[model samples]
Target: MDKQTSRNLWRITAGQRLRYASAIAVTGLASAFMLSVPLVGGYVLDVVDTQDLAQGAALLVEAANTLAVEIGGKPYVAYLVLSAVAGVGLTALGATCQYLQGRWAAIASEALARRLRETMYERMQHLPASFFDEADTGDLVQRCSSDVETVRVFLSSQVVQIGRSILLLSVLTPILFARDARLASLALVLMPFIIAGAYYFFAKVREQFKITDESEGALTARLQENLTGIRVVRAFARQAYEVEHFGSKSLALRDNRERLNRLSGAYWAVSDFLCTAQVCIVLIAGGMFLAAGSLSVGELFAFMMQVTMVIWPVRHLGQVLNESGKAMVSLGRINHVLLAEEESRDPAPATERVRGELVLENVTVEYEPDRPVLKDLSVHIPAGETVGIVGPPGAGKSTLIRLLARLYEPQHGRILIDGLDLLEVDRHWLRRQLGIVMQDPFLYSRTVADNLRVARADVNDTEMMAAAREAAVHDAIVGFPAGYRSRVGERGVTLSGGQRQRLALARALLVEPPILVLDDALSAVDTGTEGQIMAALERRRGRHTTIIIAHRLSSVRGADRILVLEQGRLIQEGTHATLAATSGPYRRLCEIQGALDEAIERDLKETSNAV
Candidate 1:
């Protein structure tokens, strides 16, 4: 892992690191008891040996005499029983220690995962809107959930096992050498090979696991997109195309995972072979030593057991390297998100209440470098004035409103709200004062009343009903079987597009912000409903500033002033009648809309006569 990634991991889990250390310490004690088991069993075998029965076992007789002198003439059988009980007791003690180590490790690792997840999620919430525009939701979800779980597994299992294995090897190696240096050297002859193999495996496995992780993230993104847009796919009759696209990503993930698993399997197979060979070499060499009187049977047996302890951990070390390699890759991916720059906001307190006097002086914005959406645009709306903005498609209408709402900062010039620089204002405070209903409004799966009150949780039922009445959706809401308590499906799928838009408008109005911007919010509603909503808005004209961006000329005809824009430039500004009388873009748009409306009316009348 890189330094920053390691730092991030430690920063999140600093409180739990001590617990992890304690768990490792306990594991070491458990390993000590485990190592003693073989030595103790070897001693028991020596004591129980009955070769040359006529002579009566010398080792057993000696042990029995010692025990009898120490304990009121108890027989050797009593000594044997005590030795068996001691072995069992040691085993039980070791098991208890192992359990404690596992429990503590689990606690530490799980807590680390939880902390990391919470931090990542909180960071995501504060990220700028542009980040979400470019980021894949599925990939982010994968990082927050699956990737963190992978790290948890590494911390809980691989890390603990690695420490245990190293401790066992360190403690047992000297004992093996003390028993017989020549045999010990042979037992560890494969150490260099194991180290070299581990290094090679770490390098190769880390890269392979990175590829697998990225592939999985991409596959998840594709699946999420397909599911979220299932309606669009069906409407376009593109099920086959979507399925093929999804299948390709799925297969790529599978192939990468298979390759990673193959690499892991090959490494372990080689490691196991090397460890087994070392054990076999020690057994053969010790047998020869025993026959030559250089080693006793019991001693040789203990030496062989100790050699196994030293070599088996090498295999486990290989597995740890493999798992930890994957975890490091996951950690790196997570760090990328955690280290991303969050949305910048002024630290100064917002002591001024917004009066909704907005001014844009030569404002310019671009989603991409050198591709300006709005260029050198200037406009002003005094407090308590209702301004209508009309523009052609791609004329930066939405961009202009977004700038006023402080959702995006302009690359050039400045925006001022009540004579204060918009950039200097606290973002949260500014947003709370501006109520916006976009062309595409999002609704949660909730009741009508709940959706209406989302912008202002403190709003009472009467306030919600009043806002719903202003949006001309009150009757529609109460007409439902369960009234305001009825559930709207995901994204308001159960409601019509027009109904969803009106509910969004109601939600914005319920907050009663000092500034309200409707970016084609009433486009989905019928002309009758739109008229009712506009009339209701007129009643609150001087109470707050309102900016309406609409394609329908009728929606803005009664505005205090209408601004016509084309190609991100304000081409005309006047009352609707004055703009209609002039020979300009506004006049042209009015003429075109008139012709379209006449044609629609004629068609409807002809259809009625035929019926």
Candidate 2:
């Protein structure tokens, strides 16, 4: 399909068409039974037309006498009694058929909703992070849930109702024309105006419903943002400000709902008026024909029955149009996300082991072209080497770490694992070779073992404990009553900052990657705990390659090589002792931090003396 056509929600859910067609078939069957009622009534009236009142009374007396005989013994009388029983039986059959038709529609609606939600979630997982930056989470949630429900309602009701109405009209119109050509022609004259009015009102409703759905999305997003940030608002003393902001969003949504209500009211009022007027006209015209002795009393009665069938469908057409309008708008919104590009990568399956030699060659990255963050920067770390990167805030430290993981692509230049370029290698394979422990690591609301398994799914409990011991966090983990099975709460809110960071480090260690990157991961721990973790890391020196970015000078002091950055440029690359003794950004930074520490110690001592 062309891109323009691809955006339609109906395309992904084309199965719904078959579902609708099935419902239409059942509705047609039920409507046929109802149409038979009018035909039966007409046939009875025709029988009346053949006889005078005395003859008709004699015919009824004969039917009753036959039924009485059946109760006693006559076979023909039994047949007459059975005919009345069959008519009542057909009426009950028609009611059952109608109920089945509605039940089938409900099943179809529920099935479509389930299929659509699953497809939407799969699409979401594949979409790139850039897509989330542009879309609101709550709005996306609403589309997957509320918007799908709207379409389902239309599928269950409007779709089948329209089919039944058309079938009823088609069957009755011909019968009416056969009975009396003049009255049929008069009734047909009002049809074009009625159809035109329905189409116009439906178009108006469709336009309003689009705005209403959009307002709902915005309202849901606003409410979500407010609730998620409630703690921040309370801390900042912004309760009144937040309340007013939320109220404004709520008011806008309410106004949109009111607009829809007004349009809906106007539409039904006009439709009812037109239908009632048409019924009145048919009654008056038929009465005149009856007075002229041009039409028989029984024939006139049958014509009136046909007219009732015709107008009933016309009255229901408005309801069908209204529901269909709402469904169309909802489908458009839901399809918007389902049709979005699956932005994550998938490649050939990868193995369990990888060597960790990393190389960056003339790398350049930019969120937008002509404003590069890292320009023509290149570095290489052999397997099992420890390299420390020191830089001021916003010196592209995190950007470099992100490139190592392929979170994004560099605008120009290449990154490689061992000798194979990262782009050419399977992303899963490349990621498996490396582990990252970040400054503010994210943890799911799951057991400690559950979170650790994200790194390497096959790791057993014994292996997990060993990895935790290597990260110097085993004592802390076991200190909790539940131990490794303890819940972390959302984002690890239940854990202290130091404990969360230690858990993250242990998770990375569990993977046993050839390369490990610590992006200021030790910033949360105390000096003594930090020392122990570093000592544990030192014991694993030749077993894994490590890249460390540190704010604390002591953290990177043991690195075999140190790279210093200022802005996006690497200005110094040497051993820690060499950089501290020589002149450059690294030496200056060390001297400044050293003086600050001394001053803090002096102030503490003076405060103690005064006390």
Candidate 3:
């Protein structure tokens, strides 16, 4: 791994690295005991075959002679029994170590999984909003979930297996050479080929796995978007079309995954044949040495056993390589998110109140290069004033609100509140002081009271009722089946458009921010309820600064001043009546709306007379 990717993996494995190390150590200990079994088996056969012991049997001779007398059997028979007992004991100890290693690995893997999830989520919260502008939520969720799982699987199994493979090769190869160098050399003739095959398999499968993973992410994204807009699809009677679209995504995922499966089948085929062939060559050569009288049958038996032990793990090397390939790809995907730049950290401010005075001086904001959304826009609104903004589509109205919230920064100018530069102060504090309700507000799947109290935890019944009343939603909330405790479905789907908007308004109101922005927020409400909400704000006149953005001329008519914008420039500024009396965009809008309303009223009157 590169230095940065290794660091990311290590950082995520924090709090559990010690446990993983311990597990690996136990695995090494287990390999030692397990490798001794072949020696015990050969010694047992040698004892049963000969009365004279080998040179290494001085210790065996003493124990066998004493046990022979006690058991009343031949010395070789007694030695055979001792060798059997030793082999069984070694196997038992190996099994115990294996159990301990598994237990530790399971615990450590779970911890690593949790740490990874937490790091990804916390990083997302700090990432600047720009990172998600063109990002897919489904792909992000896949990386956080499915990709993390792939890494966890590799850590729990393949990481330890790597150590085991190295230990096996280091220890077993020398022992084989000591017994018979010629046969050992012959046994290893295929090792280079296996290594080369494993490398090729990993290289091919890694790309296939990456393609499959990304295809799955796209399918997930398609599924998520469909579900979120299911009602839109049904209303338009596009079930057949949607199903066909989903099928295409699903088919793409299947094709990518199928390629991975096919590659795996070929890898296993070649690896299985090579491993089996290597073991057969060792056994055949050892039998020839025994026939030449240079090796005994018992010694030959031991050679076969040891050779099999080496071959088994070498075969398993393919699986370990497979998991490593997957793990590297998954870790890279997760690091992509962790490496993004985060917004400025929230800091303690010099004071609590902002005074709600905002100024924009020659501001220029752009989402793309050479294409500014707002150009040379200058405006000033002092504390305790009521203002309305009117604009044609793409005229930078919503961009202005996003700037005030610090969601986006102006490319070439400065914005100030209470004479403090926005970039200099803390962004979190700035957002907290401004309460904004968008045209389509979002609510949690929670109770009515919970939604209203979401901004502040200390809210009580009195404050909830007061805020709801101000937004003209108190009675509606009380009439629900469970009143304040009634659960609103996801995104408040159970509520009507007006109710959702009003509930969102109440939610913002409960925070009691110094500046309130309604970006077409009150559009869904009936005209009467809109008047009630406007009147409520009117009563609090000098207590807060309110900015309203609306298409309806009547909505902005009551404001102290109205500003009209077109194509990223402010074209008119005056009170509603004053703007209406002059010939401009505002007057033209009023005339068009007036004609439409008059025609509707005249049609209604004619129908009534006929009735």
Candidate 4:
């Protein structure tokens, strides 16, 4: 692992490291007891020989006497019986300790994963809106959920197993050397090969795991896009095209995963062969030494059993390395998100509550560096003034509203509410005082009442119904079987377009903000409903500042002043009657909409007469 990744891992797992260490210590102690069982069994066998019964009996008595003296002068038979019982007791105790070790290890690992996921989610919430514009939702979900799980498996199982293997190797190596140096030297010959093979595969495996993870993320993105756009796909009859696209991504993921598995399998196969050959060499050498009078039968038996213990862990070490490689890749992916730049929340205090007055002075904005969306725009509205904005398709109508909301900061000039600069105002305080409904409003899959109460959770039912009535959607809502308590489905799919817009408008109105912005919010509703909503707003005149943007000229005909925009510049400004009287963009728009409305009225009358 690189130094940065190591540091990040240590920081994430800092609180749980001590617990993991204690588990490893307990496991090592248990292993020590388990390793001694073979030695005891070998000693018992050496003391019993059938060919020389009298001599064997003498040897047994002598061994019993030595053990009895060691235990403070008990009888020889008593010593033998105690030794037999102690062996079984030690085995059971070791098993119990092993269980405890696993319990502690799991606790530490799960705690680390929980902390990491919470921290990542919190960071994602605070990130700047622009960061999400370029990021794939599916990829982020994979990193937050799947990648964290992979790292958890490594910490909980692979790390613990590796530690145990190292402990056994460290404690058993010396005993093997002391018994027969030549045989131990022969066994050590395979260690260098195993180490070199592991080192060689580590880099390759890490790269492959990274590629596989990326492929999986791409597949997830494809699936997410298809599901989100399912309605459009069905309307256009493109189900076959979507299925083919999804299948291609799935196939790529599968291929990458298979390649990673093959590489890991090859490493394990080589490691296993080396371990098996090492054990065979040790057994054959010990047999030769016994025949040549350089080794005893009992000593050879003990050496064979201990040699297997030392070599098997070395074989499993390759598997641990493979898993660790994947974990390192996943950790890197998670860190990328945690380190993104967050939205700025400067410490600018407000001494007084904001009034409805707003001013934009030479405010300029550009999503790209060289292509400006709004240029040299300036406007002012005193408290409680009703203003309307009309513009062409590429004009700066929406951009102006976004700037006032502080959704995007301008590159030059400033926006002030009352007399304070927006850049120096607390963002949360500023947003809370302004209620906005966008051209494409979004609603949650919740009941009608629940959605309306989102802007002000403490609002009473009477207040909610009043707001719904103002948006001209109250009667329709009550027509449903469950009324305000009915489910709207995902993204308000169960509601009509006009119903969704009015509900969104009602949600904003429930807040009773000091400033309300409706950016073409009523386009989906018919002219009759639009007239009713406007009449309701007229009753609210002088209560708060209202800014309306609309393509339909009639919607804004009663405004105190209307501003017309062309390209990115404000071309004209006047009252609706004055703009309609002149020959400008506003007058031309009014004429065009007037003709369309007449044609619609004539068609309705003709259809009625025919019926």
**Most TM-score-accurate candidate:** 3
lDDT (0 to 1) per candidate? 0.85, 0.80, 0.87, 0.85
TM-score for each of the candidates: 0.95, 0.87, 0.96, 0.91
Off by over 4 Å in 1: 49-75
Relative to the unseen true structure, what is the C-alpha lDDT of residue 253 in candidate 1, on a scale of 0 to 100? 89
Q: In candidate 3, what are the lDDT values of residues 1-611, reduced to their tens digit? A: 46876787778778888887888789888988987787777766666676456622566667888999998998777777777787899899999999998889888887888888888999998887798987899899999999999998887878778777877888889998998898899889898888888889898888889898899989988888888888899999999999999899999999998998998898889988998899889888887887899997677877888887787788788778876788888988888887888898666478897889989999999898988889999999999788999988899999999999888889988998999988888888898898899889999999998888788889999999999999999999999999999999988989999999999988998888899999999889988899999999899777778899998776788898998989888899999889999998999999999999899989999999999
Clashes of 3: 0
Summarize candidate 1's per-residue lDDT along 366-401 as a digit string, tens digits: 988988888898888999999999999998999887
What is candidate 4's CA lDDT for residue 350? 54
Model 3 vs. true fold: TM: 0.96
Worst window of 10 by summed lDDT in candidate 4: 48-57
Write the residue-wise lDDT of candidate 4 on 174-265 in tens digits: 98898788988887889889878887787789999999999899889888888878999999999999999899999999999999988988
Root-mean-square deviation of every model: 2.7, 3.9, 2.0, 3.6
